[model samples]
Target: MTVIVRDLRPGTPADIEGFIRVRHRALPYVFFSPASVLHGLSLPRPDAHARKLLAVADGEIIGTAQVGLAEDSREPGQGSLNVYVDPARTGRGAGTLLVRTAEEHLAAHGAVKLFAWVLDEPADRAFAERHGYRPSRSAHFLRLDLACAALPPLQDPPPGVELRTAADFADDPRPLFALDAEAGSDEPGDIATEFTDYAAWVDEYWNHPHLDRELTSVAVADGRPVAFSVAHTHDAGRYRTGMTGTARAHRGRGLAKLVKNDSLHRARAAGYTEAYTGNDADNGPMLAINKWFGYEICATEVRHVRELG
Candidate 1:
């Protein structure tokens, strides 16, 4: 059977759903929704040039690729093309076709460096290496059965600290943005990203399609947001941790655990049955926190990078 690669049509609901379905089957670690897919395509950042690529065999989508440039990075000419093939449809040339098409698209737009995330399995890693990509840092996907798992009991806030939801900042999310920028800068990763674009943040994150403000727990101290657990609910009865971090000055205060616990409890109370989150392999503190909450490592992916001329 001939495998064909093409650009995903955002206006076609079935196309979007098919693309997301293949992604979920191949990489069940992260969250994917029709809304988030379209939101990314609608990004105002011209440099992103984000396009969804699909590999089809016999009228069925068997692989998906998110091809784009990281125009926002401080480094120039950096791009990303993450590909995922349905686990049941491997060895059908769909993966290779998707990657080749995505690379051509990114190269046409001036990407001198490319990065991709491959599953930690031997075959996945070998495929990346064969494609000229080298391994880098690794990350883990954790899952918590909110319907049955025993979560850490909710605890009272330490003195001077109060727990609240992101909705509390509906009038003004500037403080949350500041906190996010500060905390996110300290995360472990190969790419050093700085979030100075407040308006963009508001458009992409604060107003995102899946952002659950009511379930997003925040910790405030001295009238400011010190820590937060951003919640994203794309599928019914399922919750994903969009971002969980504490301000620099608020680190080591157990605030991350506090807010995350609160968010998990809120998710459960609101009928969410599953919770998922990702962790950098080197992020011991956060990994420990998630472990304490009964989150188990369900999958791992290694970041891979290739240089282009």
Candidate 2:
């Protein structure tokens, strides 16, 4: 059977469904849906330079890759290509084909460095190393049973702090954007990102198809968002923690935990069965918070970097 690699057809329902299928199977800890896939393709960032690719074998998509430049990063020439192959269909060269295609596309678009997230398994790491990618940072996928587990009790905010939903900022998300920009800058990662474009943030994140504003909890102080636990839900009873962070000035106050706990409790109350989130392995503070919530480490992925020059 010949394995063929091609650009994903955004207009085709089958293409989106196949891409989501491979992602869900290869990385069950994360949440993905056709709507989210399409939303990503529709992002308006001129620098995004995003492309979704698929590896097909005998008319079936067995692997997928998301290749794009890190347009949001202040640094130049940084690109990302994350590939996932169906576990049942490995060893057929689909993974190799997808990576080669993605690299070629990125290099042609002036990408000087490429980053990928490889599963922590020996074979996955070996494959990355063989492809000239070196390990850098590691991250963990955490999972919690929202239906059966006992979530931390929702607590009243401190005297000056108030708990609100992301919905409250629907009129003007600039404050939330400011909080996101501050907290995201402090997140542990190889590439540093600064969110300066409010319009882009609104289109790419705030209006994302899966984002559940009602279930997203925010911590407000002095009439400004200090911390938040962004939530995303799928029709299939799955809930994901999109982003959980505390503003720089608000760190160490336990607000991150408080908001996340509230988000989780609300998610369960709204009929979500599973909760999922990912954190940098070195992000000890957030990891400890997740552990406190009884979330178990379900999977790990190591970031791999490859120099284009």
Candidate 3:
């Protein structure tokens, strides 16, 4: 079989759908839609040089690679490329071709270091290792049966702290951004990211197509957002927590749990039958909180890195 790699034709609706199809088959724990795929390719920063590639065999899409430079990273020459092949169609040379095409594209863009996320499965890990990538931090994907699982009862917020949604701050989301930046920096990961570009954050996150502001819960103290749970849904009965975090000053007060619980309750009530989120394996506190919410680990992935001179 001749597996050839080519740039994704964003102008073509079928190409976008095909890319999403392969991604959904490879990573069912995460939601992918044509809009999300298009946003990723067209909304990235100019310097990011983001490109989406597809591995086609016999006129069918068999694999995909999302390659781009980390323009927002504080570190220089850093790049990221996450490849996914149809689980039912592995070992067809598509994965290798996609990775090679991606690496070449990133290298041409002056990427000095590359990062990829490989499923913790033996075969996936072995493939990354064979490509000179070393394992790093890991994260767990969790899912909750919103239709059957018993969610923790939503509790009333403590006095002086009111609950709101991201939609409530549509006119002024700077406070939410500040809280997100603070909490994101504290998140456990191998690559440290600083969300200093407010404009970029607004475009990439706040205004994202999947973000459901009305479903996102925020905990406010003294009229300021101290914690938030960002929600995303695809109108397909699946809901996901894009992020849930509290400001450093508000930690240890259960604000993170407060917002997340509120969001989950709302999601369940709004006809979403499934919920998903991810946590760094080392984040015991968050992991415990999620367990208390009846979320079970469905899958895991390990971060891998390779150096490029």
TM-score of each: 0.97, 0.98, 0.98
lDDT of 2 by residue, 44-114 (tens): 86776888999999999999999999998888889999999999999999999999999998898889999
Clash tally for model 1: 0
- Write candidate 1's Cα lDDT for 141-250 as tens digits: 99999999898888999999999999999999999999999999999987778899999999889989999999999999999999999999966688999899999888
Give the count of colliding residue pairs in each prediction.
Answer: 0, 0, 0
In model 3, which residue pairs have backbone atoms overlapping below 3 Å?
Answer: none
Kindly indicate the candidate among 1 and 3 with the higher lDDT: 3
* Candidate 2 residue-wise lDDT at 97: 95
Worst 10 residues of 1 by lDDT: 70-79
Candidate 1 lDDT (Cα, 0 to 1): 0.91
> How far out, in Å, is residue 126 in model 1?
1.4
Candidate 1 residue runs with Cα over 4 Å from true position = none
